[model samples]
Target: MDRRRVIDLEEFADELRRDPHPVYARLRAQGPVHRVRLPGSDPDYATWLVVGYEEARAALADPRLAKDGHKIGATFLDEEMIGKHLLATDPPQHTRLRALVTRAFTMRRVERLRPRIQQITDDLLDEMLPRGRADLIEALAFPLPITVICELLGVPDMDRAEFRKMSTEVVAPTSSQSEYDAVVRLAEYLTGLIEDKRCSRPTDDLLSDLLRTTAEDGDRLSAQELRGMAYLLLIAGHETTVNLIGNGVHALLTHPDQLAALRADMSLLDGAVEEMLRYEGPVHSATFRYAAEPLEIAGTLIEQGDHLVVGLTASGRDGGRYDDPDRFDIRRDARGHLAFGHGIHFCLGAPLARLEGRTAVGTLLQRAPELALDGTPGEWLPGLLMRGMRSLPVRW
Candidate 1:
């Protein structure tokens, strides 16, 4: 049998930074699973690309699959920087860590924040209205969710800017030695913060809840684990929502009819957000996973220890699944979309993300009815992991 062709990760990364759907279509046409060499890695390091909807979902749901980034020697940060966080663990361990925080991310907890989220959205827009022209990302998309997460996590108001900077550097598509250093620094800062929170009395916030939580055996998260969890939640919780709001707004502005329909009826808010997630999710690829044992997906065989990259963005747009998959329609039933991922590892923050998206986009439309893109939508962030514009200059 012929070995699957390698995808040029550098070229693919360039496409991802700009626009990747066309390239995704080409890869998807090849097969359900394609072998590819990741750029900046060893020549022998071949990873499986799961791009189709069914195959991506299957890979995510497969129990034999592992989310431990260390398994395949994939390290965005040094070993000291990782510290066995939920994103770096496989089942059993991942299950335990996730369960500890699941209640905090429940729909009820998210629903209770609707009023606060709306207030934050309104306040940000209030500040931007006078500017006439502002970068939606800086003024609204980025700060709104960061503020919300800080409030939810009980992070000190004064520390938010530092946290935001650290989070951005850690997750930016382009990472260098300095960026890895930033991750270490951020981890150290979070370790201190968690220690501080532990020493203080509990408060009415997620961090406080986490601090108070213990396993059935009376075991609580270690300092390292707590720091890791805090880092993951802070970054994932805010950054993804920022893109959802930013990307969703950009999508609407680019599609006038859809924007008009949404403005004409507020009931479409839920559907519109779903479409936004499906059309352009924050994470282009799901968090990296590895095959624990040999597995076969859609007739393609994957060996144990092989790296797997599930293309959430590509799978959402698979033509076989959605009619006119390229077109963005708020009316479409996008429930099956894998934007938040699938199975046991699906995003725990989906409710919060949706609430933020609706509050941000819905409020923007109501406030600036004549909102239009201020600059050419030519510049986008570069990365295979994330898909979003670097900045959205807009005017009322």
Candidate 2:
């Protein structure tokens, strides 16, 4: 096989699972986009790669691109497992579903939860402080987001632990047949939870609110749709935020001077969070999208039905866009980075994610000013879709 072909297939997947930047840098130098073979699939399967910042933003915003997996007839999920959730829908339907939950995600609502979020952070940290040494992820980063999300969504106390277990299997790189079984179980669990909420009076929680929402035409979500919505919210809500906290802390610890700068100046918290998103965002690539029709982006013609994987991590590190793209500089204006994505499909939980990130990292610095890594920084999660330290063991 040709060296390029081999690199594009097997080696690329390995490199991507570890750290894709070096490979992405090489590809970006060639052009804004490239056609790469999709690993672990049929020989004919290939995905269009969007690497440049401009191209990624454009592709994400393009209406001709469809995010619904059923539209193109290829999916990593079972047909029944694929719900008509906002994240997997297009156009007017997507708009409608998103609007239903928009109010709960507003900045005001997120701000109101600040104290609660801080309390959650402090509570988790309280447990970690006495350990002398603890995995930041398990002790703090992972639990805080899961707990906050469970509270926000009204996930039953009985199901919260199971939910976390299934979520891990679903996102794990080496997930197998058993993992798929766990996903099905999770779906079933959510189905029951939704039904329970439907029978009961509504509450202030997100799940209850979703149950109460009706479209302008008086249409309500079907049982399947509700389950799907719950799944998306539960998974995306906690998983990504866990990474944001973990990745942000790792970034700061790796750069002592920057950490000191943040410690000295409390005002830099917001910018530091933004820098974390740009430097090592949780979601390495946006969810997949397919072209509904032929389109031209960055001088590359993408045909109808063609799959496109927006290199979000690569785009954030584009030297063409930032002066020192790789540097973890909190002072840099990293606002335009495509970490949460762009356009109509921009991440709905962005405000909440930011809030969680700010509280988690800020509380950590204050509580453990002497914090340092307990393991080598290179021991990190292996995946192309998400980037995070696997075991962030730390000591104050």
Top candidate when judged by lDDT against the true structure: 1
Off by over 4 Å in 2: 1-7, 76-79, 159-162, 377-379
The candidate 2 region of ten consecutive residues with least summed lDDT is 1-10
Q: What are the per-residue Cα lDDT tens digits for candidate 2 across 28-123? A: 888888888755655767778788888898889989889987788867663366466877888788887787667455678678889999999999
Q: After best superposition, candidate 2 residue 326: deviation in angstroms?
A: 1.1
TM-score of each: 0.95, 0.94
Cα lDDT tens digits, model 1, 122-141, are 99989999989999998999
lDDT (Cα atoms) of all candidates against the true structure? 0.83, 0.82
Query: What are the runs in model 1 whose C-alpha is more than 4 Å off?
Result: 69-79, 159-162
Residue 176 alpha-carbon offset, candidate 1, angstroms = 2.6
